[model samples]
Target: MVESAPVAEPAAPVESAPERVSAPASEAAASIAPAPTPAPDLDPGTRRGVPPVAAPQPSSVPPVVESTPAVAGTAAAASVIPGTAALPVTGGDALVLRGVTKRFGSTHAVDGIDLTVPAGTFYGLVGPNGAGKTTTLSMIAGLLEPDRGTIHIGGVDAAAKPLAAKRLMGVLPDRLRTFDRLTGRQLLYYYGVLRKLPPAVVESRTADLARAFDLEDALGRSVSDYSAGMLKKVMLAGALIHSPRLLVLDEPFEAVDPVSSSIILDILSAYVAHGGTVILSSHGMDLVERVCTRVAVIVAGQVLAEGTVAEVRGELTLEQRFVELAGGLSDVEGLEWLHTFSD
Candidate 1:
């Protein structure tokens, strides 16, 4: 029998704060059970003329697409933000934040921040470590409540209508924190059922997702038995079981293999092409330059620059611009002792 616990899903409609899971070591035994029968109701919503994804890399995978100004992204008819970067602000309202702030004790993780992501666009968030990218995304995913400021999801006020807002989004949190005791199939089942999808639809989508992410054989095993890359893939599968209007993914390509990462990018690009919106944070500047229609660079809890890929990078590349805004590289004088080994 498998060890059982409450299936901790991604961005469920929990009234209180979201419960986080601590992933432990994998178990040895697992039953090779077959997945439920699949049907054609599963729609990943793949379309063409989408963003351009990055070439595959072995260690780190990035879904960085290269989007031109004429990419024809999400509906651009929404309201313009207070101080968004210089771009033709087109697209329906996917997410909007004004004066968003968060603090941990005395540390201000996220100071006053404003962002607007249009529906159907692949938006990117780039920042150095500890730059509040995760904090901001957490707030957007409804995992952490902001100290002050308002959040709107597709024109729905998140505070007043949390459940409604959550229904419109599929969130992939930073770490692989979830109910590891259950089989991957069981976890995905809960993820869909919690969102109120019919059992058959969930089953069908589970098979589809497993096939797409190459987790067909592993779906019967407990999530705890999954490797880092496998865990990322399974959790991602769970996140997409429901065809949500907006997807909030944090560092999704981390730990995934190059082939899997390419598959993920194709799926996301197609989803965006068919009117779904995605906002994710990544450190891959090249990936961001290739995959994102618009990007925002956060530094010290503030956005230094925000605009279309072409606009933000200007004459310099995205990496160069990011380094320039992040204060460039520091001197290596302090680490000189390491070079002078006591031979």
Candidate 2:
């Protein structure tokens, strides 16, 4: 009885601290977050947030880039032009030559060559007298056949499709043999008809050329009566009248007067400015060096060097390079006595 009195009301065992309350599911989940999703495969060492590597896929589709075929031998002769590489033709490149070659009996006029000419480029072809510059140009202009090679003009294959390729080009050969009896205007008209140009267009172009080349005064005159410079100008005008994508000239300034030469140069420059391509062959290194964006130096039916003016010239001046590469001078020093008077 005495012991029970002391324990009096030992508080009904303070209800074991209200059973400890468990944390809510949301709070517990946040405390131990799921391991971060592993980063996707990508270029190694790249920073986060950068684009991930594209996954590989099995497919039969070919890649977008295709390899270009190699050109060699006569088949590669078509690419023998200078400056043309930088000036692509109107259809893709004004011209292309791949493994082309031409032979005249024992002489291989042109060896394997490759060339590309972009539209609106002023190109110069320079070489010694027999370096095949003319032969290469003739092949490009469709005047000469390559023994082996592919020639394309504005994407039209010259050998396989001569007519189409010729339509895009105007050629002025070193020797311009025309119908001497025909008047300058009549000659142009005849060529216009051959080219199948619209009558109105041909007429208008002819008139424009006449005025531009100062040929209006000579329009009614027979070609046979025209002076050398006049004939050259007329031929140039004829080539330009068709508005061809390419103008090919071989020794255009030869036998021309200074004033006429300047005019021709101005016209050619203007044509290029208006998006036309020009391929000129000239021994006048000064003229070529002054106007050409690029040049090709050929020697004995092969390309000795091909590149921009600065590239071809390198450390030597254009004149110096020409003299060195063209063999030796003609020994003009031996003729110095021509100026001496007998005592």
Candidate 3:
């Protein structure tokens, strides 16, 4: 069973401090079962959708559809229906951050970061280590509060109407965990129900996702026993089960096998094709260039540049551009005395 945790209360004011929303304890401590040993001559049925070890690498996955900006806050209109206490956005970006800031003791982890994400866009957030990418994503996902600034989803103020704002989002945080006591299928079922999906619908989607992600054979095993790659796959499946309007993922490809990574790429592409928005942060510059239509480079807690990939890259590759944007490395130093060794 997952443990419960307190949710962040509304903030004092945008001018005072940022607000953070904590995950329920159950999610924070969840675990997955270990992967079974691979069979050299396994067939499709026995493999349960797992691609053969010799399957094409992740690079072979096709590029997702090219994304274009959508009227940001227009979708919020649907939130105003009887049961929802919608955000107040009218005609703006789907996601907006104005002067968002966060601090820890004397350090400013994120400083006055402002961003706008259009609906149905595939946006990437890239930064150097300790550049505040994770911190910024955490705040945006409502896991941690910022010290100052305002956040809006579909024009609804996130701090003021978190429940409604969150309902429209599915998040896969960098440090996410799952319920260790439950099986893979059980974990997805819990989240679907928590998101208020109908039981039959939840069951059907769970089966489809398990098959798609190649977790069908392991559905009945305990999550705590899963391999690192398998765990990442299951968490990803949970993130998509709700068919949320927006997706927030951090280092989603980390630890995943190449074949499984290809599967995820296809899934995300299809989601965006149907109008879902995705925001992701990764160190893989090449992957970002291949998958994202828009990109943002941040350094020292602030955005260095934000625009279409072509605009940001200009004549330089995204990595070269990122190096220039985030302050490229100085000439190699030290180890002057090092010499080649020979047996």
Candidate 4:
């Protein structure tokens, strides 16, 4: 049973601001020293009363990078290129990609990346900006095609049998746009229908989602009027309407209020507990460490490391490990002119 969510800490009011004080650069760095690695006992899943599963051991595959061109258009409507080889999948991984590569002009966004996500795992993907995290996810979600290699969702070849593969997954990309003219409820209904769900079932699911997302009062209003946080919630609701076996989310918590973030976490935790898989990308290392059972650190279009949170981050915080892997921590150079001033 998931423990009840804690009340969100309210933001301090504007008038409560404190005066700023000048500090030495060394002192500043000291004040922000990487927080101690959170105690394993405090993992959010365990805090929520869910017995955290033992994370699988790290993969031994050395990281490799390869280049190819980006495919055009959205995953939902993209046509598979002819002669794209389909790879056979063994075992029961929920998602598998072999030699996936994508290029944008002269830049190779994703390069010959291979990944395997096991069933019922809460996996997190972390990388620096422009590191091809989104590109790789887009390909896996069938929104784009890899110039080389194959992708499989639940053992269904996404390139050769996209419709079949797509039916088993829900995707929430970094950018989401809903039909502005449709009411929030209408938007979910549309997605339900698009997924071929029965009308009666769609209605029932839509109601449940609206209540879960706390959008009951806004259901009849045009989605165009919803706040950014509300929009995210509604889009997420649409993603879940079909009860997909896998979920692919890129930065699902960004721009969300703390309360909503907690709600989303609870929903995702429950989903994973019930045998679903989720692969999400986020810059928030703290949140990733708190929730994800497994994680991969990607840099320059290659996965530098892959394993359970504790395994990859051994003796270090995930943020520290990520910085070390992506680009080793270095002291600031040539910023000697920065100084605090007061009248």
**lDDT value for candidate 2?**
0.59
Please identify model 4 stretches exceeding 4 Å from their true place: 1-91, 329-331, 340-343
- Models 1 onward score TM values of 0.75, 0.69, 0.73, 0.72
Model 3, runs deviating above 4 Å: 1-92, 340-343
- Winner on lDDT between 2 and 4 is 4
**lDDT, candidates in the order shown:** 0.64, 0.59, 0.62, 0.62
How many pairs in model 3 have backbone atoms within 3 A of each other, for residues 3 or more apart or on separate chains, i.e. clashes? 22
Candidate 2 regions with alpha-carbon error over 4 angstroms: 1-92, 330-343
What does the lDDT read for residue 19 in candidate 2? 8
Q: So what's the TM-score on candidate 1?
A: 0.75
Q: Write the per-residue lDDT of candidate 1 for residues 68-101, one digit (tens) a residue.
A: 1111121221111122121222357789999999
Candidates ranked, most accurate by TM-score first: 1, 3, 4, 2
Q: Write the per-residue lDDT of candidate 3 for residues 72-168, one digit (tens) a residue.
A: 1212312322222212212336689999999989999899999999876789999998999888877776767778999986666778856445655
Q: Give the winner by lDDT: 1 or 3.
A: 1
lDDT of 3 at 248: 79
Report the lDDT of model 3 for residue 96. Answer: 94
Off by over 4 Å in 1: 1-90
lDDT of model number 3? 0.62
For model 1, what is the C-alpha lDDT against the true structure? 0.64
